[model samples]
Target: MSTTLVQIQVEEKRFRAHQVIDRLALDIRAGEIVSLVGPSGCGKSTLLRIVAGLETDYAGRVLIKGAKPQLHSPEVGFIFQEPRLLPWLSVADNVGFEAGRGGGKHPRVGELLAEVGLAAFADAWPKQLSGGMAQRAAIARGLFTQPALLLLDEPFSAVDAFTRMRLQDLLLSIAAHHGTTLLLVTHDVDEAVYLSDRVVVMNSGPGRIAGDVVVPLPRPRDRRDPALGRARSEVLTLLNGAQQDYHDIAPDIAAAPPAAAPIDWSKLSFAV
Candidate 1:
């Protein structure tokens, strides 16, 4: 079995007494991909922040690869919802951002650009790139450090649907090739189901773990597979249940759960 790579034991995480995560314990194995899904303000991102050592105003322990993670640990890489490229930096320079943070040089900037299909854009300014291209550059930057783990915060949420799917595939491919552990926060149930080895559902009103489920499908997953649909439903059910519990006191907040849309079996194969 793969050894544990991340251990989170957050006793209390709060924003000036507004609790975010409390008594939330989670373990991620090396090379595992875990997605966090829940209603807004459920502390999913907060949990990632704790793991990455970005937020220290909490009471708890977060161990990455058997030790505490530092801000520039070189063991963690992050990609945010926005590309967050520096305007003055060329595409190639942005990709090397992690190298500078590590206080060393990354000799693979060109190789990394080529890997992300940005070889031609090496000299391009951030303003000249499309949303997708900029995001691709961010992806390259995240992987340039070759960290043992990557944390993504709705990295594809800003892109078009088609572009989102492509980025999801790209992320998985990169993780698999690099054997990098991944923890991501996403609001899309389809995305959570498709990209994660396990989907962790959280509840608001102080942010607690409601469910953790394993994805049963094999790799190179077919987005249109009935199996994927079933898995998606399972995760969605968990999310709805968590939300229902959180909103139990407020009947007006209890939403009518959306019905599952049936897929056209014949048209699925043609779906991009």
Candidate 2:
């Protein structure tokens, strides 16, 4: 049996007087790839931050391998939406930034850059690299610590569609090679369904788990597979239902979600 790598029991998480998350419990097994999906301001990012120990103001307990999470712990790596690499630092330096500026000289720096296909740009400045390249560097940096769990918040949303697909594939490959557990927050349903072992749908208005869809499909999933399409439909249904529920209860806070069209399995995509 797989060991649980993360255990979260958040009774309440708030911003000032505004509650953002309430009574949420989740467990992620080692080496699992899980994605949190929901509408904007559903506390997805906040939940990720709490897991990373970046937000301790919340009311909850989060455990990483049965231990309390520490701030900036090497066991936890976080990749933000943007690369956030220092403009003055070289690619190698940025990837090894956790070790300080001299990190560029670290041997693992070279290996990570190579793994992310950025070895040639090791000495390149952040400005010299494109958006996708910068994100690639960020991925390398996130893995520099050889973290057991990696958290990403909309990491690929900044890139173009083609680049996003490539990065997704790269992430899958890296996770397989490194056995790193991933917890991701993404608004894109297709991305969540494709990349996750489980899609955890969150409802807004004090975010709570609305549904959990397990993708039993094997690795190397086909993007066009009808099974994936069905999984995506399930997620969309859950999302819409959650939204509608929120809208009914808090009409002033959230607008109702648009009705989703039925899925056409033969097309392997949502029906228009």
Candidate 3:
């Protein structure tokens, strides 16, 4: 049996008086790829932040490898929607930034850059590289520490479709090679189905897990496979149902007044 690499139990997570997440529990096995797909404001990104230890003002316990996740820990890597590369740093430097001074000279930096097909651009500045290239560099950087888990928040959304597909394949290849587990947040259903071993569907209005769809197919997956198509339909169905449920509660929300207490954003150290 696969070991559970991550165990999350969020009894409730509130943003001041507004409850954002309720009764959420999820377990991710080692080396498994899981995708969270839902409507906007469904708390997917928030959940990812919680797992990364970037959002701590919540009621929950998140364990990675049997211990609480630590902020900026080498065991966990994060890739946001944008590449977020520092323009002053070269491709190689950005990849090894976590290693401190002369990071670009790190041997692992060279290996990671080569793995992501950016060895030639080691000396290139972020401003000179294309969007896809920058994201690739981000991936290399995310892997530099050989993290056990990588958290991606719509990491490929900024790229074009063709580039997105290429990056998806590249991600799969690298994940397989490194045996790194992944928890990805994406709006693209096809992308979710193609990349994830399981797709978790969530609903908004105090976000909660609506359902889950398992893509019981082998890797090096054929995008055109009938099984994949079926899985996609299943995900869409769950989303549609969840959407309807959210709409059903719209009238109640419209009638309700604003939250009595609001969080002071500036005071909080963690991202909301």
Candidate 4:
């Protein structure tokens, strides 16, 4: 890994009476997909916002490609839980918004829409599209600027299971196709294990990373694979413990050996 494409080093971050992040330090390499998992109010979203240069009121340093991040960085794109599309804007127009970013040449709107399977819906209104289609359009918009980093905050959480799976595959394909580094914040352990190259588990209340586990499983991975199960178990173990006790289990669970027996993939159930 090169000298990290994104570096988040924060001593403290607060919102009035609530403290969000505490002594957080992480270096994300180029083209890597990393997930951040933790309990609610762990500052996961806040950290992501800082990385996108959207929240600068915190006490910390976020360096993108060795330089301070800025608003509309063109190097970073964000996709929130909801599609948050401008309902009135046509799909093409929403995607075309990326063009106004400092006169940068980007992948064409038609091509981007096509990549997300929205080729024919270019002129369609957001209300005319289904939930999945709208989210896909949001994805296309995110990729419009050809960002080096894509910040996703449970982008697939609102969709159905099947749709979420498809979107997960879409995300992986997009990352592989564009060589874009991804930093995702997800509550679904399986989803994190399924998509990430590495999973960094954090503890809540003044968020601090407890463990960083590498998912050694191969790409285009099988959901039935026991390796993913083991990885998910490790993350769950980390999350199941008290925030302070996370330090104790992070290494042990991560160091556990891979499961040898392949369980029926359908038999095991995980988050919605």
Per-residue lDDT tens digits for candidate 3, residues 226-271, read 9989999999999998888787878565345766898888887965
Question: Where is the poorest 10-residue window by lDDT in model 4?
Answer: 98-107
Global CA lDDT computed for model 1: 0.88
Off by over 4 Å in 4: 100-107, 242-272
Q: Give me the runs in candidate 1 sitting further than 4 Å from their true place.
A: 101-106, 249-272
What is each predicted model's overall lDDT from 0 to 1? 0.88, 0.94, 0.94, 0.86
Please list the Cα RMSD from the true structure of every candidate, rounded to 1 decimal place.
9.5, 8.4, 10.3, 10.1
Q: How many residue pairs clash per model?
A: 0, 0, 0, 0
Q: Give Cα distance to truth, residue 124, candidate 2, Å.
A: 0.4
Candidate 4 has a TM-score of: 0.86
Could you tell me which residue pairs clash in candidate 2? none
Q: Report the lDDT tens digits of candidate 4 across residue range 1-272.
A: 35589988998998998877889999999998999999777789989999988898888798999999899988999998889888767888888776764212244888888889998998788999889988998898898889999999989999999999998999899999999999999989899999998999989655888787799877889998999999999888778763545435355643458678987899989989
State in Å the error of residue 78, model 4: 0.3
Clashes of 3: 0
